[model samples]
Target chain A: MIPVIEVKDVVTHYGSRKILNHVNVDIQPGEIMVVMGGSGSGKSTLLRHLIGLERVSAGSIRLLDQDIGHMSHHELTRFYRKLGVAFQGGALFSSMTVGENIMLPLREHTNLDEKTMAIMVRMKLEVVNLAGFEHLMPSELSGGMLKRAAFARAVIMDPALLFCDEPSAGLDPVVSSSLDELILQLRDALNMTIVVVTHELDSAFRIADRITVLDKGEVLTIGSVDQVRASTHTRIQDLLNRRFEETILDPDEYLARLTGESI
Target chain B: MEHSVHVQPNGHIVSFSGEIDLENSPAARTRLLEVVEYATTVFVDLTAVTYMDSSGIASLVEAYQRAKKTNVAFVLISTSPAVLRVLQMARLDKVFTIHETLEHAQHAKH
Candidate 1:
């Protein structure tokens, strides 16, 4: 099958600093591609390049077999309509109610009437477990609720491609796991290409079909979670092993060690 | 929608018995809300609550949410395994303070 998104040797730079260098990834339709990295590792820059929000300095970016660099204005609009993006912080409109916020994209994109839009809104809310909170203002919501509302808005159009940035950020573990489950369901049910940018290891492993690990503005390693976990590349080993160590250790034992206790 | 409230020196105890279903939910919700208003802590006994549906669950959740908002310690007591299964399925088991018996729930408060 043709890849939904293909990036070959993509090099993105901001001024003199290279944000992404020689990065390559193939995102298949209906699979989730997680970009994993530490802070300032240029994962966001790569996403920006993929969505055509920022141009790559060198190399090729192809979506649906068309080079994004050569797309015309009309073609670009059509291209954007096929994809949905949920930015960090949700980025919802402060002036609009949650229902109105989700309805904006549908209203602008389709000719559905008020009743149809209301039904669509309720359906989307049900998907995200926010069915009755549609009438509530954004200010009335908590952090997790805001994220789910934004997610509801993102999928309102049922785009072919969906991108999420740090979906678990600022969320508790329970809520974060639920959101991961929702993302998995979205991918399975919608059959859309999902690209997630995040540093959370648990969330990444829980949702990713494949992961591209970046370090110092370059592709460190790209593989399934098992391969990445078993990898011996210095950086990958160091990162994965460090987290593994914490999970394996008993907290009380570790604390005792910190207190200089034997055994 | 029968409510039996036992008043003590410190607080009032409200015991919810029988089945909570769509038929009696609204009235039950109203009475439970009112009963929780005067108590420092409210223990809702669900052992005798033989049946519940989504509407019953919604009403119970609303009661719990309201009690939380009002700063009353809400205790869900004697949750039958059947009721616990429903709560667990809905992911509400983690949200509420549930116990196997009324005394166990009361002991937890101390």
Candidate 2:
């Protein structure tokens, strides 16, 4: 199938350091495509390349059959309207009430009158389960509520492509799972193509239709969670099994046996 | 009144026998903390507990820490199998001693 977004042999660099090398992937519509990696593994860098936040150093990134790499500034501005980004921190304005934050995008992008905009704001808040708290300032909300409000703002325009950076971070597991369900609900409700950049293993396994794992600027594997878990690739095995160095450490008495040292 | 603290001369028993959820966890926590103040051995009876979530677990962990600070030995008893399973899943059983009945728990040495 022709993908909604396709990157072909894309090589992106920061100054002289190459970050994304020969990266190629395809994202389909109405699926949650997760980009996962360890820290400094270029997950965010790849997102930047995909969203046109950074220009490609080589190759092409095609979005909706248009070449995003080669677009002019004016064209890129028009193209971005179809995409939505909920930053890792929710990135809400501290000065604005929840209603204003959700209303900003609609106000800037549409010519709707005050009455219509107000209704739309309420609708978006309801989508995120924050309907009645629209008048509350950002500081008055809990961590989970803030993330949901930011999510409400992201979808205010009913974007075709929704991008979330670590949507589950800082939330407890139960709350995180609920947030995952909300993301899935939004995807089905709007029929939107979703791309999530996260390193959370449990969340990734729960919500992803397909996952693309990156390590040291290279593609590791791209498949369903079961396929990735069953893969025998050394890197994949180490990651899936969580074979961190700390977990392998023997008790101090056992360690002393190997070192021939007294405890 | 809220949940009661049975203050015997030997130990303090704070028994909870209902749903403990996020909205009411604060009250539960306060009740348990108050019980720890009266006795060196504090027993929490949860055999009647039907359901508990992460917030309830967190409140218990907090109470455990507070009891430790006061040199009180905190123990949990009579957790329903369902609630016991959740505590075991979260690996809190290793940190807490689980008992089949409040009497068995109160009699066991801390």
Docking class of 1: incorrect
Q: In candidate 1, residue A133 scores what lDDT?
A: 93
TM-score of chain A of each: 0.90, 0.90
Top candidate when judged by lDDT against the true structure: 2
- In candidate 2, what fraction of native interface contacts survive? 0.00
Residue range B15-85, candidate 1, lDDT tens digits: 66676643565566666778777777887877777655334555567667778888988877755655665
lDDT of 2 at A57: 87
lDDT per residue (tens digit) for residues A19-89 in model 2: 88898889998889999888878899888888889888888989888999889999998788778888888
**TM-score, B chain, candidate 2?**
0.89
lDDT scores in order: 0.78, 0.79
lDDT for position A56 in model 1? 86
Give the CA lDDT, 0 to 100, for residue B12 in model 1.
60
lDDT of model 2, residue A191? 65
Residue by residue across B3-109, what tens digits does model 2's lDDT show?
66787766887887777754465578667767777679888878777765434565677778788998899988864765665465435678887788877886788
For candidate 2, the per-residue lDDT at A116 reads 44
In candidate 1 chain B, what residue range of length 10 has the lowest lDDT sum? B51-60
